[model samples]
Target chain A: MDKKKPKKVFVQGAIPPEKIANSVANHQSKTNIGAHSIFLGQVRADEVDGKTVTAIDYTAYEEMAENVFHEIREAAFAKFDITCAHIYHSLGKVNVGELCLFVFTSSAHRRIAIEATNFFVEEIKAKVPVFGKEIFEDETHQWKVNK
Target chain B: MKVTVKYFGLVAEAADKSEEVIELSEVLTASELKKQCLEGLAITDKDSVQIAVNQNLDDAITIKDGDEVALLPPFAGG
Candidate 1:
């Protein structure tokens, strides 16, 4: 596999569930992979004050974010013996209970795939220039900070 | 010298603009420029903001002509 090529990481709005299934089906031809680890991030309906979060309006420094995502992919490939890795994140409004982020990693063993997936998730949360605005049911909003 | 400054997320909302080009009469490091751009903004935690010069996160780097600078708020990705 060409590991150095940077893949598009951002998708508009919410990522469809069918995309995940299609991704899994596409990898069936690669017989060298024995395990696949997936991580899906869903928008949560958390109550703040008296209102509940209805959605998140995600935004990013797109140019910088793409670079950071590429860097994260390179680092993960260097640190783990993984067959492949794929990441997708939402760029616009994603409603509650909808998928916002998807991380998929495949490897010859289960441990490496799991570890690579975790690495991608943590790095993305810490390093990427993506931001989220939590919109409440009453149309009010607040900036979301990663803990 | 002039440099293009970009803002994202809360910073953009606070600034009311996504991008702007500023003319610098004196040399300023990335952090200094960040502060200048963010002056009077309503962002509560200015310390949590970060500056990126030419797509690399570094506050110590001095701003140069035609450089791309970005003001980034806290990341909330997964």
Candidate 2:
């Protein structure tokens, strides 16, 4: 156990790959990790029932969402013997085929990281307050929220 | 209390905006907003709606002055 408290963040903004890469480097330096699994979610240019998805406008109830995200992260750490985890998601109007989310988890072994990554994505989808609007190429649009 | 109601995803289609302010008293809640939404607009499937107050999922949340509320429909993004 370290003297400093662990950091949990939920940011409703765009994420740069370099920042995440740097954070991962920091985590690896702290732990003798054998495996680091990363999951990236990218928006795709496609259609919803014949309407092509040209762009996605994302929005969030930022304060509440951050609170929920931080709590979930703490729960994950309590359940897994992981070195570190990070989740970054985007906000505002994201064009078709843009990266919106990244989940990186590192642990002492491959098995733990893999399982933890899966759990991370699942919990995020179910719990996080992020929302998106799927914009069709034709100009028609629809809201994108969890079922 | 006057609070703003925001619509997102499918819910936005129904309300047709990111958010709007309505004159409400303390008795007004998130659920009442859904009803008002249906009455003000021709929105269907009121039960399928998801409500957020100040950005978190608030099904039965109460309203306050200057609070912003968001209405969302079934999430379809990954």
Looking at model 2, the pairs that clash are: A61-B55, A143-B9, A143-B10, A145-B75, A146-B75
Model 1 alpha-carbon miss at residue A102, Å: 0.4
Q: Where does the lowest 10-residue lDDT sum fall in candidate 1 chain A?
A: A59-68
- Clash totals for all candidate models: 0, 5
TM-score of 2: 0.76
Docking class of 1: high
Q: How close is candidate 1 to the true structure, as a TM-score?
A: 0.98
User: CA RMSD for every model?
Assistant: 0.7, 3.6
Q: What is the TM-score of chain B in candidate 1?
A: 0.97
Q: After superposing candidate 1, which stretches have Cα over 4 Å from the reference? A: none
Q: Model 2 chain B, poorest ten-residue lDDT window?
A: B69-78
lDDT per residue as tens, model 1, B1-78: 999999998999999999999899999999999999999999999999999999988899999999999999999986
- Give the number of the best model, judged by DockQ: 1
- Per-model TM values vs. the true structure: 0.98, 0.76
- C-alpha-based local distance difference test score of model 1: 0.94
True contacts kept of 1: 0.92
lDDT of each residue in B1-78, candidate 2, tens digit only: 788776665566655676677787547777876677666665567787777777656667877788777776655433
Q: Per-residue lDDT for A1-147 in model 1, tens only?
A: 878998899999999999999999999999999999999999999998888999999999888889899999999999999999999999999999999999999999999999999999999999998999999988999999999
